[model samples]
Target chain A: GGIITQTPKFLIGQEGQKLTLKCQQNFNHDTMYWYRQDSGKGLRLIYYSITENDLQKGDLSEGYDASREKKSSFSLTVTSAQKNEMAVFLCASSIGLANSDYTFGSGTRLLVI
Target chain B: LAKTTQPPSMEAYEGQEVNVSCSHTNIATSEYIYWYRQVPHQGPQFIIQGYKDYVVNEVASLFISADRKLSTLSLPWVSLRDAAVYYCIVTDRTGGLSGKLTFGEGTQVTVIS
Candidate 1:
């Protein structure tokens, strides 16, 4: 009975502007992840954190940065928004590698105009 | 990271059993097969996972082959609300402590009434 909360479900940003997305999970899980999904596409890894203050780059790590400030919260920042870019950013968390049952947040829809 | 291959799309009718198959011929011994479903405008949701043999949960069932190269996810009963893109993935043991799951283009299941 835990919840992953993603702030600002819909985000609109101008080209070249920096945007930040936040994710908070009350599951007390040790690992957190960020993924990006385009329309009609599968999910792509962006960044992941194993524990607090740990950061690891994923396949789609370019142009984005992630932070695991605390065990309950992880945040993602877009270095520079791309014009006409639209995608959904998802956040997920799990206990550890041995147990891969992850809980994911609804997502933050990003639109760069 | 083990590569996975699954059908791009599938069709099923309401009240019918829907099974989606995935092949991971290069799966390692420690890797596990996982099934996830993504409804439109939502994050991917975990269905079931298994290492070898069969595993079932309240939502779905996962059957892995003895060779561990192929697996199938079965939805007991399909409905209009069950229509979504289903993803099959294998656990990534490349990064230490980073439990990354690579998602490929999943099977889009269209449910008919």
Candidate 2:
């Protein structure tokens, strides 16, 4: 079994501040993704990486940046935190191109004041 | 990507079977149905996926209709741990970073004693 670890489970930031969340996976997966979950709304994809250093933007990519520093790690940065953007950010990884092999991290809950 | 619709919430008792249904009226022939669940304060967890017919694993069973416009996830003998938001997603066969999922509000299954 492998684990996807997300650092600093809770994050608090002021409006207009820049915040970054980190994710690391030991599954040796080939694809990684970042998703934001609002209270009533479901998850929306922010960004994803096919491999190390390869990035792809999703429907909700604006105001957010992602980097796959290495095959085992992917990071997401909020360019400017806003109260409306405060939500739980989830990191997930899948083996190769298979969707059924997706494994997720605990998540980073962000709170912007 | 095919849009999905699910119930806003559902209630089930412990040891009872729970069947969550999803509708995708415009699902393409090349798309597949996927199921995921999210417990409070945690990332969404992939439960199952199917192309057509029926697919079953240790955790759940997926039943897809003939037209592939509808699917159901059946969990037998559900417990309190099963209480969570269940998501159904539809997407094409393409994988990698290009195959990001679009999630809906999902069905919140509350398992009561």
Candidate 3:
């Protein structure tokens, strides 16, 4: 009965350029997450927020920055795009970890040249 | 985060039941097994999850062994739309607030007519 919306279905950036992806969830979930998926690979966590103004670093948060300015929105910024990089970034939200009630948004496909 | 292992690929025919197994030899006591599917150009969708024994939902069923070391997700009456990459994950669900999801190389399931 809820939906997560991600902006910019496709992104094209130049090498060393800064790119950003945004996500909005109307599920009123308490936790939000960002994951990146490379070709033929699994999803990797980038960052997460348990509540508004709370940020946590994930395994692959090195070159990324995240913000939870509002409970309904979470944003991810790529510090510097790598050349020839292509990947899909997903946004997900959940009420709690107790059950697997996680919901995801259509991902943003990023391509750097 | 307990690591998960699943087949790289699988195939099934329409109207057939497809079962994908996952192995988590070192799963912890408080961990849970979750299954998600990702259609091309879409975000991953939650299918089912189980802590122990068997759990069923409208879309799929999750079966866990007594030892909790292995689990299976069964999707009945498969169709062409069922073709996608399936991911099995193990995570701690204590306090109803698990951190981020750790994904592995999922199983690419192909449903043929």
Clash statistics: count for each candidate: 0, 0, 0
Local accuracy of candidate 1 as per-residue lDDT tens digits, B1-113: 43889989999989999999999999888787888888887788888888899999899989899999999999988999999999998885455633477778899999999
lDDT of 1: 0.89
Predictions' DockQ, in order = 0.56, 0.67, 0.67
Docking level of model 2: medium
Q: What's the lDDT for all of these models?
A: 0.89, 0.89, 0.89
Please write out the lDDT profile of model 3 over residues B60-105, one tens digit for every residue.
9998999999999999999999999999988887643243567788
Weakest lDDT window of 10 consecutive positions for candidate 3 chain A = A94-103
TM-score of chain A of each: 0.98, 0.94, 0.96
Model 1, A1-113: lDDT tens digits are 99999988999999999999999999899989999988888788999988999998898999999999999999999999999999999999988745667788999999999
Candidate 2 lDDT over residue span A1-113, tens digit each: 88999988999999999899999999899989899987767988899888999998988999999999899999999999987556899999987655645788999999998
Off by over 4 Å in 1: B92-98
Q: Model 2 chain B, poorest ten-residue lDDT window? A: B92-101
True contacts preserved, each candidate? 0.53, 0.73, 0.82
Tell me each candidate's RMSD, in Å, in order. 1.7, 1.7, 1.8
